[model samples]
Target: MALSEAEWKRRQEEEDAEPAYFGMTWGEFDRLPERKQQETRQRLSQLGATHVGFWKDCTLGKCRRARRCIGFLSEAQYKAGYNAAYPPCARGEEPRRAKIYYDGICRLFPEGDEQPKYDGRRKTGEEDE
Candidate 1:
């Protein structure tokens, strides 16, 4: 059954009302400490390749949010001179917050040796007890 216009609108509003991250806005994320922001950026970088692939596939496959993520990424790439002929989104409704959230999430957790060690002992070069 098709949803009524009112019902669809209500659902959209509810989704919009939900916070993009832990009840915090993009402004809040931006205002976080430099270390925190860097941490978030590192995590986001870990997911960067995957997210880019998802956006590219979505663009080719015509996913619903494709216009938003793809458009934003394409525009950014073009602006950065990475691509010379990227097309603008037809819908013109970029996923502003979604992009910010994803980018922030990407920076959260780092990998490899960059990850912090939690050994409950003195420094490696320090004299042992």
Candidate 2:
């Protein structure tokens, strides 16, 4: 499906700062190169900081900057969502910021399009609530 104009712009803004990945099966991410995979590891590292330490380096100052990050799902998240079964990263690719799949978006998780929340509420008064 075609993305809306605003949606296109938002994706572009995040293209550099916060990492993003299309809905891909785990098998696809596993096949990527090491450098590409390393980016996810870095994001996971930062995710660790948000919980354990007060001081942490911002990988990117803004989600727009983080958009360039290659952060993605490991075995767990992908397995939960993806329909097809695939082996996990066997190259010993370390864990990543499975928490922050998208930068700055802490609560959102990819449960297919159900989580994206693009559609309007069922009723008009629901907008206020």
* Per-model TM-score versus the true fold: 0.24, 0.26
For model 2, what is the C-alpha lDDT against the true structure? 0.41
State candidate 1's TM-score. Answer: 0.24
lDDT of 2 by residue, 1-96 (tens): 999999998876565444344553445556678646555444544343344321233333442244333333355545465311111211122222
lDDT of 1 at 81: 49
TM-score of 2: 0.26
**Regions of model 2 farther than 4 Å from truth:** 1-23, 54-129
Q: Candidate 1 on 46-73: residue-level lDDT in tens?
A: 2442344434434444433543233333
Error of 2 at 28 (Å): 1.5
Output the worst ten-in-a-row residue range by lDDT, candidate 1.
Answer: 83-92
**Residue 96's lDDT in candidate 2:** 29
Query: lDDT values of the candidates?
Result: 0.44, 0.41
Q: Report the lDDT of model 1 for residue 71.
A: 35
Q: Report how far off residue 7 is in candidate 1 (Å).
A: 0.5
